[model samples]
Target: MTLLYEPERFKDESRTKRSKRQLLLTKAEEIFRTQGIASTSMIDIAKIAGVERRTLYNYYNNKEEMAIDIQIEYLRNYGATVEFKINHDLDYTKQLESYCDTYIKRFLNNKNYIIFITQFDYHFRHFSMDDNLDRYHKIMKDRNMTNNPAMEIIALICKQKELNVDDQLIRKFFFTLHHCILGVAQRVIFRESVFIEEQDYSSEDIQILIPILVNGIVSTLPSYQK
Candidate 1:
């Protein structure tokens, strides 16, 4: 007699494995934020995650790989949320506002992630030469071409308004918007003295800042002026 296998059992096992992996990644992220990546060992992550050292290695080969995975996961989740907000807003200007508002709120709410992103260049250097790291970065860059919310917003404005502006100019406009958001987010995250004298900035401050930069961009667009 031949034995048979159930597909449902295999599906359940796959889901269980994914849950375990996500749990481990969440625990490791907390440790990375509190202890800093350089000082954190795989042992530390396993201890904090309340899992065996062997089990941790079963999911991630090393701390560097795990950290990169965590960062990529964060980006994927964040991008999806922003895309949802932009997609729902039918008006072009409303979509732009949603983009700015969502980004500001998300960054402000996730201070740890903001801190990680602000120091990403330094942290990434540790694994810069790794093939996996380089390959993942290339893949993400390619993926961003269609999935990027800011780029989609610009394209929508140009298409909906029938603007005759050069493509390069529209790209430059998006770059400016990107820089403005990142610059403010870094300043708010670090509490830079030049941007804010206080130890913190409120959501209200960010709400005010978004419109100013976004409107400035709109004012410069040929479609807006006409």
Candidate 2:
């Protein structure tokens, strides 16, 4: 029995679909980054993508759907980078700092993406965003993407520091840290001078406070001796 190769026509069609989808997302992200998501429409995206309205619809039902997919794509890249940065050789504090550094570097490297996220948070709300996020998480789970990078990093910390605490306790701590870092990064990108001009503190200095806070928390952890 011989295995039959897929026909060239089918291969070409698949490639064309992928190419068009990529073009659609590229154009859509550009519009989203410049014009707020609420201001941008399917027609605008289609026009920028150089595709018919119906063709754009063939890929996504609405801008919300495309936005969710684009977010998932960015997060997947971030997750991969986080996974790569996890070093078992480092001690607990260093590992935690590495995680924070990853976020700071990635956010500073792509201010546009950080700006887009700020816009997205301001514009999207209620049921539609919730439903889309649920769908996005499902896709991530199906693809075996890391569901919680912070959880993974914290677990490593527990191992390296010889800390024995309840899983729930560590989870709560790490999640809080995760959001705290994220919120700080977004603020840094959106209002670079707010900290300095108004608060008399440099944004960089404010960011440094997070690692110091993290170190303080780790020091106080019941199992952490140093």
Candidate 3:
């Protein structure tokens, strides 16, 4: 007797596969955070994920691929959050402030992930940024977009204020702010706060730096006036 195909069964199977994949990813993330990525193996991941070694391999070709997938997922989430914060009816300065503060807070919250990704790349002799940027470019290319989240937000603010600037200038401005934020985050993470004298920098101190950095960058624009 011939059996009829059940679409619901197929849907359920797909959902199960996705659920298992996410579970493995989550377990791998935890192991990477605690034991460090360099020390984590496929067996360790499978044991932590409570899956067979073959099952983990079925979802990912190898551990590096799995780690990259996790990083991409994180970046996508980060981009979405930035887009949500910036895509609002508020004025440009307010939007910029929100963007800056959100970025700082997010990085501070995920400092471990940030450090893990960085160390993973160093251990593997890979540049995770290169991989991340390649994926970012592909997505942007598919969407017929050029600027990243940071660049797009900065451009929006400039356009709203009628600040005339070329793409190159806008890019420079974006990188300037980007590096500033990263520098501040690095300092805080490493317990080497630049401006604050305390060994432990408070969130309030970081909040104060956001507006100062934003205003410093804004003040450099040709259209900006004292």
The most accurate candidate by lDDT is: 2
Error of 1 at 212 (Å): 3.0
**Candidate 1: clashing residue pairs, number:** 0
Total clashing pairs for each candidate:
0, 0, 0
On a 0 to 100 scale, what is the lDDT of residue 171 in model 1? 68
lDDT of each: 0.67, 0.68, 0.65
Tens-place lDDT per residue, model 2, 125-185, is: 6324556778776765665424456566666666666777676776677666766767776
- Residue runs of model 2 more than 4 Å from their true location after superposition: 1-13, 84-90, 126-131, 139-163, 193-206, 223-226
TM, every model: 0.71, 0.73, 0.68
Candidate 1 stretches with Cα past 4 Å from truth are 1-13, 84-95, 126-128, 144-163, 190-200, 222-226
CA lDDT of 187 in candidate 3?
54
What does the lDDT come to for candidate 1? 0.67
For model 1, name the residue pairs that clash.
none
Total backbone collisions, model 2:
0
Q: Tens digits of per-residue lDDT for model 3 on 1-226?
A: 1112122223555756766777888888778766766788999999988989998888776777667666656655543234434555767766777777777778777776555555455655653343444654565345422546666767776777777778777777777787677665555664434435655555446678778977777666756422
